[model samples]
Target: MPSRQKKVIFCIAGLLSFGCALSVAVAIGTQFWVKGTILCKTGAQLVNATGPELDKFVGEISYGLFHGQRVKQCGLGGRPFQFSFFPDLLEAIPASIHVSVILFSAVVIIFSLVAAAFFMYNAFGNPYETLHGPLGLYLWNFISCSCGCLVMILFASEVKLHRLSEKIANYKEGNFVYKTHSEEFDRSFWIILFCFTVHFLNILLIRVSGIQFPFQESKETDTSTGAADLMY
Candidate 1:
């Protein structure tokens, strides 16, 4: 690749890495990972509510990894109640899985920033042998991609397979009891997915910048050596 093309590719990859980092950070901090409505099962049963009266027993819930809000619509006009995960709800499996998700997200952000820095360094600054070369780009981008994928997969499993929203809603406290009616991943979840996809795309961008796939390069080297030996 020409010097100008290399610069453009590296710059684009760097910008994408930064975007992934920002998206992961925002997704971690926001309470929009999962959004759904829950029914106040106990409340409905207590009042023997039926038909339209049951509508009053529904509540809105939205939460991320750390904190969230629950709006009680059980005839209370959507009074919001805030909740936290750490120390407060850590005992729950969903909370534990979410904590892991957050950890992986942090990993993704850290490695992505590192990759972006390396990209810029290779593009403009003087690069050394291993740390600032095509190998380094591959390494950093691979790590970021793996971590981002982990974040998405873990969160998705918690929500879809483990029924995270339902678990959180079903948690009871003294006289309070809740039941999940329906749940789905919200904007933050999709943002995380997008970030994962971006990191994977960055890997492709690195390859397009004239860096051979690491394994393929090694295979070619061995094949050349064998051919040379046969000629000798």
Candidate 2:
């Protein structure tokens, strides 16, 4: 590729990485990761709430990594409440898994910024063959991608396997048990997924900038040597 074309590709990749970092940062601070309805199982059963009557016992729940909001309904009215994860609900939730998800999310943001900086450096500044160059780009992108994957997987496990929504709904409620009625990953969760995809695309952009994948050149050289030995 021409120098100008390579510069353009690097700039685009860098911009994309920076954008992803910003998006993930915003997602981490927002309460849009999971959104669902929780049904007050005890209340529903007590009143034999069937058909449309069950709606009276269902309320909304939405949460992110650090904090969230829930509306509790037990056939009376929706009662809104705000919650935090650090100290408030630690005893009720899977603190370890939840913390791991947050840690990986931070890693993704940090590495994404590093990748963007490296991309810009390769584009404009003089870059060496190893850490300061294409190899470093690949390393940073791979790390970001891996961390992003871990964030999604860990968070999903915390939500599904641990029954996060239900736990939050029933927290401190001794008389009524709450069950998840419907749940879906919201905007913030999808932003992380999109961020992961963007990093993968950056890897391809690096390839388009004329940098061979790590070890690919070495494998090609070894193949050429073996063919030459046979010819000899």
Candidate 3:
């Protein structure tokens, strides 16, 4: 790749990583500002003013992270699906949003793989460009690991707000309360973090998403020439 083209690709890589980081940061920061109050039902309403204040912050955070766009809600209502997102954005949607999220997620994954493959194909043959060979696979490794940070931020937001936890724990008990957040997905954030960690480390071992190829040239395959080694 020419230096100019390399610069453009690098910019794309930076944008991809930065955008994801921004999403995580916005969500967590919003959660810290506005986690809702824990109101004990059938007993006494906790009069802590901080409760509503916290809730407002959390609500804003959820809205911002989910982007107020209609997406599929977890199981419920019509066709086993309905509109869903952070509680604050639920009103923004109607009918069904569950199908939308699945479709969006699929697109993101497919494009992500395509981008990764592009990076891999270039990085393989040329040691200078192959991220692992010379440009440094560790840099891309850092990008992959950052996804885990996203999950941590999510968990912290929820942990700060105990309301979600209380609801799940109370499932066995007859007393049930409506949750502003979805327990199913948020609850598994930590597990996802674990997967990210393992995959990130695994990349270092296998070298970039298992892109294993001939690293050392055999005597018969040697193509090195003095001129080709010259730097651009």
TM-score leader: 2
RMSD (Å) per prediction = 2.1, 2.1, 14.5
lDDT digits (tens) for residues 1-232 of candidate 1: 8989999999999999988888888888999988999888778888898998989989989998888888876665677788887767767656667778888889988988999899999899888767678778889888888887788788889888887776676655556577788888889988877877887888898888888887888899899999999999
lDDT of 2 by residue, 1-232 (tens): 9999999999999999999999999999999999999999999999999999999999999999999999999999999999999899999999999999988999999999999999999999999988888889999999999999999999998999999999998889989999999999999999999999999999999998788998996798799999999999
Query: Candidate 1, 216: how far from true, in Å?
Result: 0.9
C-alpha lDDT of all candidate models, in order: 0.84, 0.95, 0.37
lDDT of 1 at 185: 85
Q: Candidate 1 or 2, higher TM-score?
A: 2
Please give each candidate's TM-score. 0.89, 0.95, 0.34
Residue-level lDDT for 212 in candidate 1: 88
Residue pair clashes in candidate 1 = none
Clashing pairs in 2: none
Q: Which parts of model 1 are misplaced by more than 4 Å?
A: 47-51, 94-96, 128-131, 228-232
Task: Give the local distance difference test score of model 1.
Answer: 0.84
User: Residue-pair clashes per candidate, as listed?
Assistant: 0, 0, 11
